[model samples]
Target: MFTRHHALRAVIVTGLATGAGLLLAPTASSVPVPDRSAEHALAALVSGPPAAADLALPRDFGRRFGYRPTLTQGLLGDPSGSCSSPVPLPAEFTAACRQHDLGYDLLRYAGRSGRALPPDARRSVDTQLGAAFEDACSSREEPLSLASCLAWADIAEGFVRVNSARQDHAVPESETVRSIAPGVGLGLAAAGGVVLAVPALRRRVGGVR
Candidate 1:
């Protein structure tokens, strides 16, 4: 008795919310400081999801670090300059090294400006290296050193925040994206409901639900 009642109530709540949300969702050309090119591009994707080639273009921060795939995931969740860092990640131990080796070559590009390392920064790197080495060593629960090195690199010290010469935007471009997302989300949810409410669509809805 309680199970059916709850499910019915939930469906009612979901449908009403979905309908109202879609009806009240934002519309085009409402943006105040409209960058039409960006707006058009986003609208195209919202109307239709991006093609694979569209996703192939690099984000600005990712360009800074070149082609490190996990740099952003390593550093931040962003998949940009964070983890798949331009700085070479430390290599895992091999049969020859005996001990775990940090065969990093990424720092070769650092300090092209000839700027001196501040004392604190120098200390931080030294401390991080020590911690990283220790982490990479014992973490190898396996009989081999290679396993430990892999575990530690997941949290190794790969961070350096550089100030970009370009000016930062005062307002977020995401603000516009945010405004558009709600409408698109409501539309999708309503479409999903229409699909779900049909008995013929039950199997597909089961997978989605």
Candidate 2:
């Protein structure tokens, strides 16, 4: 009962539908799965250092940028480390601690690898940190907090290339000093002058990691 033209049209329509689905299948499967094991390992490295007042004090600053308290609670808690004197991390800093640890671990990997970050990895860090800076700057809160902005700037300096001429030059000290100066000035008004002594501290901390 089917006319030849009608049957031909039906066959073409089904073929197109099948072809369209096949084309979309690859895109759906191409998405990378979240690497939980890698993230956990990185998180452990972050929490391994003994908790200190200096480490925990940045929580309030992190809060200003919307660090969720519930999610950060256990993540920022104290870890067992060999510290002569240990300071308990405040509940407030949990989110900040986790965020800092993750960022630090990722950048540390890039640094230790002794090669350029893959394009996707580089873009991922750049986009996240850039967006955070923009959000911090746009905050309308009075006596505006720049802690997140400064912290992000510090993290960003590690990955952002300042000197393309050298394939293996360390991140410039001046850039880091400049980025964190505002945070130190705002957070530790009286001790702001001592920030210049950070290069020595950097050597110590760099060795520890």
Candidate 3:
């Protein structure tokens, strides 16, 4: 029977689900687009060698994004991000990770400035990251060390590629969640409806008998 208990339960479940969905949904914010020249320069830096990247650091990039590029152990520094993997990678991979972080930052900078790069831009950056990882492994001369590095490189690249596929290209991380929130909300609502309907359907069948 659809007793008072069932009715109360349904109301509570529906309310919670709807409320959560609303809270999780993304909101839009507007910011003036920075000059295209700055974005172009950042893109070039991401693609170019680490030595050349330092040249752009002192220009409009530092003033606009508050990004002060530093040099660490001869590699470009990425204080804002790093190789955040569950398992430790070879130390040589540090340079590759720093470069990859720069590419992601470019995407974030473009997004916050109201000018988003195309999806292909992200793909291109990711591809380069994988290549960099491979190159790092290739540098190992010892047979065992070479094998181990190559194996880790495969694992790292696979993880990165999969994660990248899940993200919205050139969008800030928070905005990506917002973009997908409505679909998630609708799914939750649908699930709640099914739960409530099952009890009602059972009660109706009992009455007919």
Candidate 4:
């Protein structure tokens, strides 16, 4: 009986060892990974000029606003199309200008931080601007004037979004890595759980003495 029990134990141990060897074996995907540093360096070298231009927000700000008439309307001139005179702007138009400036400043800060607006924050800003635009455009006082102001704000916000870190071509590697690590970690954890369960199989066999 003792010899039989010993033989059974040896078979079980050998099976478990084989199973572990298979589990730990290097699959096709486990082959040596290629060095991406060279590729990344080459890409950065090629993209240097364009990346610099995109980051130069303040320098391009004037030209961009100048080309967009709606953006300059309330900013450079009053409701009566007077640019030189210092007259008080209509309330809605003033608010529009404020919002546009706010958005522009916020975008500059984000650019400096090397980050993009989160979805919730972006959606909130869009919704708020949309609501304000509708209110101002429908107002009885200087409706056309206020409409121009809201249009300016919308254009500024659009520019910010386009130049932001959300652009696929310019997105940081850190962001992509952050998005993928969690799923990979979960897969590894599941595999580890299976490996851990293997040790418990010996307790279930009725032949062990």
Q: lDDT for every model?
A: 0.32, 0.38, 0.63, 0.40
Candidate 1: tens digits of C-alpha lDDT, residues 1-209? 67998999999999999999977887553423333332332233223223421343234323543443222111111122122222233443121111101111111112221322223333333344444444445444433333324333322322211111111212111235554454445444544443334443333223222
Candidate 4 TM-score versus the reference:
0.26
**lDDT per residue as tens, model 3, 50-80:** 6776765535556756667665444465656
Off by over 4 Å in 3: 1-35, 57-60, 63-66, 71-80, 172-209
**lDDT, model 1:** 0.32
Output the number of the lDDT-best candidate: 3
| TM-score for each predicted model, relative to the true structure | 0.22, 0.27, 0.58, 0.26
Task: Compute the lDDT of residue 84 as modeled in candidate 2.
Answer: 12
As a TM-score, model 2 comes out at: 0.27
Residue 182 C-alpha lDDT in model 4: 49
TM-score, structure 3 vs. true: 0.58
Error of 2 at 172 (Å): 16
Candidate 2: pairs in clash: none
Ranking by TM-score: 3, 2, 4, 1
Summing lDDT over every window of 10 consecutive residues in candidate 1, give the lowest-scoring window.
96-105
Q: Which 10 residues in a row give candidate 4 its minimum summed lDDT?
A: 76-85
- Cα-based RMSD of the predictions, in order? 26.0, 16.2, 23.1, 26.8
Stretches off by above 4 angstroms in model 2 are 21-28, 43-103, 107-185, 188-209
